[model samples]
Target: MYDEIFETVVQITHHDYAGCIDKKGWDHPAYFREQIATRQLNDQSFEALMQDYLRDYQELHMGFRRLEQESQRDVGFTVRRYEDSLYVTSSQQEKRIQVGDRIVALDGETIEQAAKRHARELKASHHEREDWSGVLLDTSEVEVIASSGGGRTLALQAFTKLPHTPSYKIESVEDTLILTMTDFWNHDAITELIRHNEGRFQNAKKLIIDVRTNKGGSDLAYSELLPYLFKGSHVDLRDFGDKAYTLCTERNVDLRVELMDQVLQTIEDEKTRHQIDVMVRELKKNRGNGFVELDLSEIEDNMSFDTKQGPEEVVVLSDVFCGSSGDSFVETVKHSDKVTVIGRPTLGMNDYANVAMMTMEEKFQFWYPTSKSSAVDEGNGMGGVGIQPDVYIPWTPEHLDKDVDLERSMEVLENFTHKGSNI
Candidate 1:
């Protein structure tokens, strides 16, 4: 049993480490087997072994961190990076924490002080700080300075302060429709957002999508929005090595393609069905080779605008906090003339996607990015290098008093009107 477990772990790691693994680091399957051949298989020992393996692939969602003894409580809010500080934007109602609160300290140490102290353990990016804030919230109480110039303490609890509503918000800003999506985890929410805002989206001359703090979730959620945005035929590509697998079930190697099986079965039009059939067949033709082309125009789903008429001018707000599926969304749309990305560079975490979850025993589980993606830029593979914005606007602390990024976006749109995008 021990050898079997060790072999399985090695097999999964070798095939699913997102990027290539260094043999000198821990790539030797035989060496790993020998190292743990004598240890008794328990939660503690297995977790310790897993930790050593995780240190090498520190990319976002590259590995799962499951502490057998640590409490899983969280503060009711999530935060994002602005300048060099972390600020709360959404929270659960049970906690006193509110949106626009800046996290100053955790466990009694100032954030800057903590970052410096833990520098060796953390990555050299603002996204690391944002993630570390969430990690801290999992275990300790935090100190925050609210936008109203007051201070308070927030502690972790079973419930979070973030509202359990739709992940997106649609509102009018002059002639533009401002759509702020906090995440893409809820497919139902995405559908509701599109259905609810179909009329409003058509009336607006332009649209602004704010995904600054979105860390990502399901691709199915954001892909539902692509049909409305892209005008012409486009192809998106993904790779899953020679083979792909999800820990959840024994489906085909590619889960994204597998999701289409249900949709294909429901289509009644033979012509539409044939077009989709070709796309799906092409997507799955060479599953083992790792690269597959997806035709955007072929996919027929009900999650789009009836007119198929998108905004004349589009703006996307991004930051280093936009990671995972958020990275995928930005990378996919960056090339279109209909959209312009603004603000800081997004968090690069989508190069390796299609996370396969695996549970070890009953206490530990592992989530690995089994599929490699070339959607944003072919061969570039957005691992550490994320999507860059067309218009660069750095966030300043004073912007907490004034919405600088939004104002800049509005100005850019107005300039496009008068200057015809020359400015």
Candidate 2:
């Protein structure tokens, strides 16, 4: 029976973010009861049942598409957001579709309307422009109209290459360091990049950390970059004046307890060990509190910086693609007076974080957000709204052709350097 999947989803969402369920209009007890009966009567497979349920939950309700398959196939081109419109930025070896083509229509809907639909399926910002993976497909064909007013229909297998991007990039423009953080896939890659480029970073007068296309990977990746950003004796992703909480089923609680116990055993430091012990104690103390207060940031007092390295003035280049850890990175740095955010708002994905994977029937796996952003208490953490940039620079087709964001950033740096003006 698919009862386990329904029960687990209900329990998790009910405890974690009942508001999320309510927003979907899936909060009706009788509705779920009826759906359960239908599922049993129909004898639905776990994958089939959950995919349909989550498609409604994610795409219809949340405004973002759910990724069901493991591997992704490309449509011979890449689409980027240019103010709620999806534009073909790059194509794999110029396969049919050329660059600078705007996706005007997809499956009979206008590109703008489809972009909104795509944006709804996202767990991050509701801003339609932030969704970089425009119109993903498995086996279906996507019809698009180019910016040049030409139209063509293509399938997923049309792309000769895979949907791929580099891990990270470091470049030097005059005295400024243009650090392009595309993905946070590897913690070690971040560490190695900093380690290998120590000299270049030290010589730079200003730094522009471009996370425009960063879709977020590991918190550990951003944590590794902290020492460079903050020239302190220690670093901490501390509580920014809010009480954090996590909602979990008894099964999740037990798993967390087990993991905590295992981690506690591995820790040799007396002070650190004691801290973990206290955390475990408090978690168990709260037990069935439904939403128990928890610290989401990792506190590391031992992580020391070079002090002499890194620039005093930093600017973060953000857009709709900057989400999850990318959004969190922006939130962390925006607290500092030295950093100025440029370009569009970040892909606001702070709410409903720390996804926990649940498996049913030992085959179907479900990913649920066990905790929400601390900003939820402040009435500012909706998945649709992103963090606004200090300097609001929206991208255009002209800007894309001329690399306007980079040019504007360099101009700002030049003015800051010569005139001593913050602008």
Instruction: Give per-model TM-scores.
Output: 0.68, 0.75
Clashes of 1: 11
| lDDT tens digits, residue span 257-346, model 2 | 666576566545454555556656655766666666664234334222334456767888988778777887887777655678888887
Quantify all predictions' global Cα lDDT against the true fold.
Answer: 0.62, 0.62
C-alpha RMSD for every candidate: 6.4, 5.4
- Candidate 1 residue-wise lDDT, 383-413, digit = tens: 5557888898866565556778898889888
Model 1 TM-score, 2 decimals: 0.68
Model 1 worst lDDT window (10 residues): 239-248
User: What lDDT would candidate 2 get against the real structure?
Assistant: 0.62
List runs of model 2 lying over 4 Å from the truth: 1-3, 16-52, 55-76, 81-85, 92-94, 112-143, 146-149, 152-166, 230-242, 254-289, 295-309
